[model samples]
Target: MPPTSVAAPPGAVTAAERSLAPDLARGVMLLVIAVVHAHILHTLAHGGAAPSGVADTVTTVVVLAFGEGRGYPMFAALFGYGLASVYARRTARGDTWPATRSLIRRRGRWLFVFGILHTLLLFFGDILAVYGLIALLFAGMLVRSDRRLLVWGAVWAVAGTGVYALVNNLLVADVEGATQVLAHPLTDIATRAMTWPAMAPLLLITSVFPFLVGVWAARRDVLTAPERNRALLARTAAVGIPVGVVGGLPYALVSAGVWAAGPGTATATGWVFMLTGYAGGFGYAALIALVAARMGARRGPVATALAACGERSMTSYLLQSVAWIVLFAPYMLDLAVRVNGTAAVAMGVGVWAATVVLADVLRRAGIRGPAESALRRLTYGPRHSARGAAAGQPAARR
Candidate 1:
C-alpha cells in the first residue's frame, strides 16, 4: 500500500495542526447535535412532558437553561468556519476559485446523500438533509462579495428563524398547532429538505449566511490562527449568547409549555426568534471553534474522543437514530413514553458521553470511527487507483 497521506488542500492549516485538532471540534459539535433530536422524540411520545425523576428534573433544567438552543446554533457556526478552512486550503495551494468551488460542490453532494439516508432510515429529524439542499443554494453565492454574502445571509437567517418560531407554535383549533408541521414525518422531512417555493429560499438564505460567515472566518484565518482571533470570538459570544437566549428560549419554552401556544392558535411567536436565533446559533459556532482551537489537539482525553467522533460524524449521527429507535420505539425499548424532559436529556447526554469514550478507544486502537472510515473510503478510497497503484487505504471498506 502507498503510505497513508492526508494532504491539506494546499493551505487548509499550518503544518503544526495537520494532526487531529480540527477533529476535536467536529466531535464535540456532533455530540451537541443530540439536543434537538431528543426533545423531538419526547414530544412525539408524551405531547411534551415536564421534568420527572430526579435525573429527568436536572436534564429539564439544563434544557431550559442553555442546552435548548445552544447546540444547533453552534453547529451552524462551525459549518461556517469549516467552509473557510476548505476555501483557504485550496487558495493557498494555487488552486483557483473554480477548483475550490467544485470541491465544495462534491462535498455538498456527499453531505446531501448522507443526509437523505440519515433522514429516511434513521430519525426523521436530520440536519444533513436541510444542509444538503441549502448547500446547493449556498453554492450560488460563492462569487458574492463577503459583505454581500453577510448581508443576504443575515436577511434570510433572520427571516427563516422568525418564520419557524412564528409557525412552530401557532396552531389551528382543528389541527394540533405546530404539530401540523410534524405530520407525515418523512414528507415533512422531505418538504424541508427539497427546494420549495414555501421554504427553500428562506432556509437557503439562513444557512448560506452561515456558510458565508464561515468563508469569512476562514479567509481571516480565524480557526487556523485562533489566538489572533480571540477578541472577535469573544465579541461574537457577547452578542450571540443573549440573542440566542432571547430567540431560542421561546421555541423550547412554548414547545415545553413554560409559555403558551394555546390549544388552537397557530404559533405566532416564531417570528421573534428569527434574527436573534441565527445571531445566537452562529455565535455558538464561533465560540466553540474558538475554544477547541485554544484547547489544541492531543492534550485532553475528552478532546481526543470528541475529535474522533467528529471525524466520523456520518456514522455517529446515523447510529444515534438507530439507538433512539431501539431504545424509545413503542415496539422497541419504549423508553420514550417512560421518559420526560430532564430524564430524556440525561439519556441523550449519557449517549453523548458514551460516544466520546468509545471514539477515544477507537482512536487509541488505530481505528477510524465506523461511519467515518466508510465515508473516507467512499470518497478517497478509489483516488489511489487513478494514480496507477493500489490504494494506500483499503479500496473498499470492510
Candidate 2:
C-alpha cells in the first residue's frame, strides 16, 4: 500500500552534494546541441543544399559523426540519470514509491508545460516535453527490477531504430519543407504549434532507450563514483565512440556530396548512423565521466565553468533557443540564409561559449537559474520551494 502521508520530500540537492561528472556532461552536451540545431536550421533555410566548401564538408562530417543524433541521447541518458537520482534520494529518506512517483509525474507535467511554451515562443525542436511525457508514462518503472529496465530499454531501442529508418526512407525529402521558416511570425508560431505534436512522439520513441540506460547506470552510481567504474567506463568509451564515428561516415559522406548513393543505399546507411549514435551518446557520457574522475576534486576554472552551465542546463538551453530565433528566424536576423554551413557551425560554438560565460556569472552571483527555480517550485510546491530557494539547491534533474 502507498504511504498515506502527503508530506514533501527534502529540499533540492545542495551544491556540495552535487557530483561534477554529470554536470560536466550536460554542459558539454549543450554545445553539441547548439551545433546540431544550428546546422539543421542552416540546412533547412538553404533547402538542404550539399556542403559548399571544404570547411562545410568537414563541419558536416564531424557534426554528423559526433554531434547531431548523438547529443540528445546523451541528454536523455542524463535526464534518466537525474530522475533515478531523485528516486533514490527520496526512497532512501523513507518516502514511499507511490509518493515519489507522484513527485516525478508532477515534475514531468510541468516540464511538458514548459515544452509547450518553449515551442510556441521559441524553438519547435524542444525536448523538454518529450522527457516530460516519458517520465509521466514510465514513473512506475523506477521501482522495477534492473532486468526489466534493460529488457524494456532494448525493446524500445529496436523499435526506435526501425521507426527512424522507415521515416528516413519515406520522408527524407519532405523534412526540409516541413521545417522551413514562414515569412510571418504568426504563421511560424502556428506551424510550430502544429508540427511539435507530431515530432514529440517520434522523438520520444528514439529517446526512451537512452533514458532507461541512464536509469540503470544511475542505480549503479556509474557517474557519481566514476573511479569505482573505471574499467567499465574505459571499455564503453573505447568501443562506443569509434562505432559511432564509423557508422556515421557513410551518411555523412552522402550528405556532404563526397560519395554518391542511391535512395536505397542512403536509407540503409542512415539507419546504421542512427543505430550507432546511441553508442556514441553513451560513449560520450562515459568519456566525460572518465575525465571527471581524473579531475578528482580539482575545480579548475574551465571545469567549473562547464559544470556551472551544466547545472543550469535548462536555462542555458532556453537561452540558446532564444538566440536561434533571433539569429535564424526569417522574421528576425535571418542569418541562416546569410551564413554558410561553416559559419553556422562557428556561430554555434560562439553561442555556446557566450552561454558558458553567462552561466559562470550566474554561478558567481549564486543565483539559481530562473527556469530551474520555477521548475523546483512547481514540482515541490511553495513551502518546500521557498526553502530550496533560500538554500540555493537546484532540483535533482536539470
What overall lDDT goes with each candidate model?
A: 0.57, 0.86
Q: Write the per-residue lDDT of candidate 2 for residues 91-144, one digit (tens) a residue.
A: 888888888888899999999999999999898889999999999998887888
Error at 228, model 2, angstroms = 1.0
Over 272-297, each residue of candidate 1 has an lDDT whose tens digit, in order, gives 54456567665665676577767754
Off by over 4 Å in 2: 1-11, 175-179, 393-398
Q: Give the top-scoring candidate (TM-score).
A: 2
Q: After superposition, how far is residue 23 of candidate 2 from its true place, in Å?
A: 0.3
Question: What's the C-alpha lDDT at position 118 in model 1?
Answer: 69
Question: Ten residues in a row with the worst lDDT in model 2?
Answer: 1-10
